[model samples]
Target: MRILCIGDVTSPKGVEHLRQNLWRVRKENGIDFCIVNAENAALITGASVNDAETLLSSGADCLTGGNHTLRNRSVYTYLDDSEYMLRPINFGEGTPGHGYTVLDCNGYKIMVINAMGNINIEPVLDSPYSYIDRVLEREAGKYDFAVLDIHAEATGEKAAIGYAYDGKISVIFGTHTHVPTCDEIILPRGTGYISDIGMCGESGGVLGMNPELVVKAQRSRMPIRFEAASGAPRATGVIFELNESTGKVTSIKRIAF
Candidate 1:
């Protein structure tokens, strides 16, 4: 089975870009299932209900979130009701949405987990290592394969999780950094791993935001509302081919444009 996981979508243009191209990308790549990180899809901060609906209708089989996911409170209800939308699992109790979901792909159950690393991240919650252990144990025998999107800043933290869960998960990919790493590889234990899958947004800016605005904020140390860049948007992600019976990744390939 083949699965594709996309990085964060920064703005409306990023969402539109996916609306226009994702279906074709899926078709051309023969992707069986797709997961997209869209916490920033509404604007530059948080996604709204419309953004979620648009991404779902466009092509994503599931949507994942990061630290900025709940910034817009408008999506709370949809997050609870939608079986395919996820928030960081370690957000602790009483959070709006779930951190993981089990998607039925034909007869196979694919479990998708979203987790955040605490280092230099806000509202720090449970340790991803411990929370994931609890989750894996609680959900045991419930899924045929597992995949995790570790939303984090530090590359070391992402790498640690990848190594810790190498044999336990089918794929482990990092997000939130918005910069693609060329180190896509099949781990020693067969899990497909990448430090970061990059992002889907305007390409000619600083992490999808307007460069000028970002520079202004940095230079002035003031509260500046950065806007999405106007350059052509592109989608970046990685595809994992897993052995159906073993649930181990057979190959990993990075995709962009």
Candidate 2:
């Protein structure tokens, strides 16, 4: 089976760009399951119901999220209502949506989990390692394969998760930096790992935000209204093949189009 892990979608432009190109990417790459992070889908804050619907209807099989997922209060209902969408698992028990979703496709049961790191993030959550440990104890055996999308700032934490789970999870990819990392490798235990998958928005902008806004905020040390760039939007992600019987990752190829 082939799985595609998409990076963050920063704004409306990102959403529209994906809608226009995602289907073709899926076909060209022979993707069986696709996961997209749409945390910054709502103009650099959070995603909306319409944004999630557009992404799902386009090509995303399951939608994963990061820290900005709950920024939009209007989408709170959709967060609770949609099974295809997910927030961070370490957000704990009372969160509106599930942190992981179990998807059944073509007779294969695949588990996709979303998580956030706390080193440089807010509302300090529980340890992602501990949360995933509990999740595995309860649900890992029942699924044929597992994918962990760790939206984090520190590379060490992301690497730690990959090594901790190793053969336990088929694939582990990081998000939130909006910059694609060069390290894409299959661990010694057959798990696919990448430091970050990059974003699906403007390739010319500063992490999907307009360069002007980012510069203003950085130079002035004041809050600047950040907005998504209107440059040529591009798609970024990774495609990997996994074994059916053992549920181990066999190969991985990065996709940037």
Candidate 3:
């Protein structure tokens, strides 16, 4: 199975780029399933339902999020209704949205799991490591492959999770930092891993926010509202091939264009 995992779509501009380019990219690459992170799609703190629909239309089969998942109050309602959207699995047992989703890509059942990092982030339900172990145990032998999106800030934490799940999962990609890491390799166990896939937005800006505003906030140490950078957009992601029978990754490559 071929899967394309995109990094965070930081803003509407990033979303627009995906809308314009995703289909062609998928077709040219022969991708079977696509996943995107949409935690920062909203103009403000909360995202719009239209954001989710736009990503789906852009060829993403499933959408996942991190701490910003609940920024938009409307997301609470949509989480209950949508099967393709997932919040962090460690957000507790009663979390509105699911933490993992299984979809049929061609004849293979692919499982996608979303987990959040606790270091320097808000306190959530449970530890991400424990949560993932539980999910993998329950879903073992039920799916053809499994992919995890470990949205986190600390690179150490992300790398730890990647190593821990090396053989068990097909692919483990990180997000949230919005800066693409050069590390891209398949683990000894056949799982593909990267520290971060980066963000799809203004490459010239700070992360995906306007550089001027971010500079001001840093220099002045005052509260300043950050806005998405407006300029030539760049898309960032990774593509991987998973073996159906063994549920392991065969090869993985990074894509930034």
Candidate 4:
């Protein structure tokens, strides 16, 4: 079985690009299931119901979130109700929505967990290490395979998560940092891992935001209205081929367009 995990979608164009190319991408790549990090699917940051719906209807089976998950309160209700959408598990204990979701693909139960690293992030959540451990312990033996989207800033933190859960999970794909890393590899125990899968947005922009706006803010040291870039949009991610019977990763391939 093959599952595709997309990086963060920064804006509407990013989501649209995925909508336009996902079907072909999935078919050509033999992807049976898809997970997308859409924390920034609205504009510069945060998710919107419309964008999330577009992503789901187009191709993604599950959506992951990060620090920006609650930026748009309008989608909180949707998040709570959607079985395919998830917020960082470490968020406030009473936060709406789920931290992980189990969805079906060809009659196979696949569990997808969304977690955020606490290094420089907000909302002062619990340690991803502990929370993820709890989740894995509780959800053990309940799914055919498990995949994690570790939305984080520091590569070390992401790597730590991957290593900590190496043999215990099927795949651990990183997100949050929009720049793609070249560290895609399979762990000794068959878990697929990547430091960061980059993002689905304008390749020409700064982390998918208009370069001009970002540059002005950097140069002026003041807040600026950073807009989503309109330059050529692209989707970046990794496709994992799992050994169905064993429920372990057989191969990991990086994807970008």
Tens-digit lDDT string for candidate 3 (1-257): 78898988888888888999999999989999999988887743545689899899889999998888887888888988888888888987666788998888898888899999888776554679888998999998788788999988889999999899998888999998888898988898888999999888766789888899999999999999999886799989999888777877888888976
All candidates: TM-score: 0.98, 0.97, 0.95, 0.97
TM-score pick, better of 3 and 4: 4
Q: Best by TM-score, which number? A: 1
| lDDT score for residue 257 of model 1 | 75
Model 4: runs farther than 4 Å from truth? none
lDDT of each: 0.92, 0.89, 0.87, 0.89
Task: Give the Cα RMSD of candidate 2.
Answer: 1.1
Per-residue lDDT tens digits for candidate 2, residues 1-257, read 99998999988888999999999999988899999999998876789999999999999999999888988888888888888999999996777888888998679988999999888877688889888888888994688899999999999889988899899999999999998998989998999999999998876788988899899999999978988776899878998799988878999899898
In candidate 3, position 197 carries an lDDT of: 92
Ordering by lDDT: 1, 2, 4, 3
Report the error of model 4 at residue 179, Å: 0.7
For the record, the alpha-carbon RMSD of candidate 4 to the native fold, in angstroms, is: 1.1
lDDT score for residue 114 of model 2: 94
- Between 3 and 4, whose lDDT is larger? 4
Give candidate 1 regions above 4 Å deviation: none
